[model samples]
Target: MQALLQEAASRLHAIEDRLTVRTQIAAAVAAMSIALVSTLAAGAAIISYRHTAALIESSVAGIASSTSARLDRFMATRRQEMKLFTELEPMQRLWQGDPTELRSALEALQRNFDFTWIGFADLNGNVVASTGGLLQGKSVAARPWFKQGLENVVVGDVHEALLLASLLTQRANNEPYRFVDIALPVRDTSGKVIGVLGGHLDWTWASNLIADVQANDGNTDTRLSILSKGGMVLVGPKRETIRYGGDELADMLKVRDGTFRETVDGQQMLTAFHVGNGYRDYQGLNWIVTAS
Candidate 1:
């Protein structure tokens, strides 16, 4: 009876040991399964994040491309209009030393094109005829546009309309008016450079152009600007910081045409640029058109 009892006790002990080993094995398998699942989840999350980032970048690039192209077309149209103005019969008559024809021609042009002012200057830089007759006898020899227009067609940088302000006795508001001058050399029938035909375009017209782009795209967040090659802001949003050419815009002067990522005014931006390529026979001003 004692031997039988010992055998029963030994069998019970062996069964318990086997049960403990099986439990340990099951626990190890479960731990490994959990670890594997966690690693897979992490990898999937990383992949999803990268995919989302790529999609966002692609969308931004598309918008930049479309906006840049639209702006380029707009600039091209303006250049064409200026070219056509240089070829007008009245303008040609002015080049033939008929200063009397200038007022009527300029008035017609202003009525048709909505220019702020259309002025013609003789070779001596004396204003012979003007739309408003304000600066008819004024000499523009000291102006940058006059010097530039002597050799080729030129588009002057934006500046305060000091002449216009001084000429007008009445005031619509205290706000200062700004204007951009576009000038082309007038040639006689013998191809002699005789005079210059120029016009002052209101700054508001440029602002409206940008506004139209934004309205068409329904994207108010995007920024559009026309910049000088020297990094000066020719036309931009109402924001004083951007309009004045902040430090962030410094690098843009070095880039002729391309896309880059930048931080502007504490906001991350993707910017694309298009350098002016002269349209047809017109030589472009080499300005930079930026979309961000």
Candidate 2:
């Protein structure tokens, strides 16, 4: 009995230590599980954010592309129509010395196509026949369209109409007349270049197209802009002159279609851009379309 008691006492040291070790191991396992779950949650959140941003960027890019395509098609169709109209025998009869018939044809064209003005200019830049006869006998020698038309088919960018502004019907709010020029050299029966057919499209047509795009896009948060090759804002929601700097333009030209975060007029925004690629047989003006 004495030997047994001594053996039992030797083996009976601190049984609670095993319990403590077990508790520590259990706590460590719980901590590891929690930490793993936390890491996974953080990673998921990051991925979700990136995905959402990508989708938003893609949406805006689509808008910009669609708008650019529509504008290109419209311009292409008009230019193609003009190219065909010029080859018609009725138009070729203009040089037959009947100014009234020529003027009548110009008026019919303006009426059909919603042009602000249409005129025929001789090689010497004399306005021989016009839509309303307003610029008749006037010399358009200094006009860019007339000069460019002498060489090749031309479609000019938007600009304030200098000589035709006051002569045109004024808006109630007194906005100046703006125009986009379409001009091409006319050829005689023997394929000799005779004169130029110059037409001024109402800039309102472009503005209306923009309005329609905005309305159809169904995104109130999206802002759209039409920018010239020079980066000047040709049409936009705001009246301020918004122009992209050289650095921005260079980056945009590199991609031609993409999105970037930017600050415009003190507001932070994400902007998507698409460059214009003109339709068949028409050279694009390199206009940039933007949606933010």
Candidate 3:
């Protein structure tokens, strides 16, 4: 009986060992399954992170490119405008005295500047003199531009060269010419209107100026012109002759002002208005000059 009891005890011990070993194996398998799932989850998170980072980089690059393009354009335009104004400053200074000096300066201007015509008009709106073509000393007193000056106290009339192109027929060739005119008012120290200082400019100079204004970036063509106080069109291309006193410029007449941009007929024009101080120490009969 003792032997039989010992044998039973050994059998029970073997059975208990086998159960322990199976439990340990099951625990190891469960742990390995959990580790594999966690690894896959980590890899998916990394891929998502990479995708988000790429999108952010692309957005930033696009914005930077757009900003750079706009900035480049603005700087280019400002530079060209500045250069043109500088060229006119010396002529303005010489206009304050000696009608002869003004005439001589105009002669020099015609020779040195890029225009098919350069001339002057007296306070009565008559063409006193001109250089560079047959229009010199020709009477333009009857022209609408002249009439507009007579009515307005102190503002410039800007317009296209075409209005005055009738005077620029070639001597031997049937070639047509173009120009830009800036009809400035001549003033004395007493701030009185004396006469008008006119600039007959070559279209090339202005066109070159517009080209140089890098901000334009070939987006649109630009034209420059001055309007009378009543909003009459003084300068531009493809302009039709309109009656003076009844125009928009006459109705919107205002004080002397300078520098603005507007759109006309699908084109952009940047302009400057040199408003006159009527007849105070003025060097001419038309308008006074005061750094406008």
Root-mean-square deviation (CA) per prediction: 4.2, 2.9, 14.6
Residue-level lDDT tens digits of model 3 in 1-292:
9999999999999999998999889999999999999999999999998888565444333332333233223333332332343246565555444556656666765565454554567776655555643455566666554555444422223344454556555536653444434454555555566666555445344334423442442332322332334443333343334423454343223433434344656776443334333332222211111110
Maximum-TM-score candidate: 2
**Each prediction's TM-score against the native?**
0.73, 0.87, 0.36
The candidate that wins on lDDT is 2
TM-score of 3: 0.36
Could you tell me how far off, in angstroms, the CA of residue 204 lies in candidate 3 after the best superposition?
2.8
Cα lDDT tens digits, model 1, 42-87, are 9999999999867655654565455545544555665557668777
In model 1, pairs of residues that clash are: none
**1 or 2, which is superior by TM-score?**
2
Error of 1 at 166 (Å): 2.3
Decreasing lDDT order of the candidates: 2, 1, 3
lDDT against true structure, model 3: 0.46
User: What would you estimate as the lDDT of candidate 2?
Assistant: 0.86
Writing each residue's lDDT as its tens digit, candidate 2 over 96-207 gives 5798999998898878886789899999999998988989999998999999998888999989999898788889988888888999989989998888989888888877
Better of 1 and 3 by TM-score: 1
* Backbone Cα, N, C clashes tallied per candidate: 0, 0, 50
lDDT of each prediction vs. the true structure? 0.71, 0.86, 0.46
